[model samples]
Target: MIRTATPDDVPLIHAMVRDLAEYEKALDEARATEEQLREALFGERPAAFGHIAQDDDSGEVVGFALWFLNFSTWRGVHGIYLEDLYVRPEARGGGHGKALLRELARICVERGYERLEWSVLDWNEPSINFYKSLGALPQDEWTVYRLTDGALAGLGAAVE
Candidate 1:
């Protein structure tokens, strides 16, 4: 079963995020704290939303997806930018990942969103193949860029 996450699920969400980072070989980079997640997910103006996938029989949350809305100026529509989607190692091959994605797709269709998108590490062939199997196309022509940490701080200081 899959359902929208609530504030009470912040701890689980944080743990799952760490698990995902570990799987991606970047555990040290998972620096988000539970308080940050709570504020971001359930603050006065939420910055993102989350979904949890549970095992019906065991009633345990085995996976989760965290996403936020983004505007596509060219398309003149909104889209969902999935930041993380993960299923526990023991829960693989159980359709949980696909179910979470399908739920996101359904939300897009219901809300008239233009697209649902996320980035995957190039080395993760298994996830790439899974996404392809769902008919998701890769935007290979576009390059992703980042401006964070010191660079981000530098830009803010320059403006000041």
Candidate 2:
């Protein structure tokens, strides 16, 4: 079963995020604190949303999908930008990951959103195959760039 996350799921969500980072070989970069996740997911004005997938027999939370809304000016509609999607190693192969993605797709269709999109690491062949099985095609023509930390601060200080 998949359902919306609550305040109580914050700790589990944090742990899962760390587990995902470790799997991605970037544990050191997973610096988000539980408080930060709490504020982001359950704050008075939430910036993101999360969904939990539970084991049918044991009713234990096994996976999650954390996402936020982004605007596409060309489409003029808000689309979900999935930040992370994970299922415990032992819990994988159970269709939980696909179910979580299906829930997001359902939300987009219901809201009249033009697209459902997320990024997968190129080296993760398993994930790439899974996404492809779902009919998710890669936007190979575009490159993603970001400014962070010192660069971001320096730009903010620059005079227009």
The segments of candidate 1 whose C-alpha lies over 4 angstroms from its true place after superposition are none
Q: Which 10 consecutive positions of candidate 1 have the poorest summed lDDT? A: 151-160
Task: State each candidate's clash count.
Answer: 0, 0
Over 47-80, each residue of candidate 2 has an lDDT whose tens digit, in order, gives 9999999999999999999999999999999999
Model 2 scores worst on lDDT over the 10 consecutive residues at 113-122
Error of 1 at 47 (Å): 0.5
lDDT of 1 at 133: 98
Segments of candidate 2 deviating more than 4 angstroms = none
lDDT of 1 by residue, 66-140 (tens): 999999999999999999999999998899999999999999999999899999999999999999999999999
What residue pairs clash in candidate 1, if any at all? none
Instruction: Go through the candidates in order and give each one's C-alpha lDDT.
Output: 0.95, 0.95
Report the C-alpha displacement of residue 51, candidate 1, in angstroms.
0.4
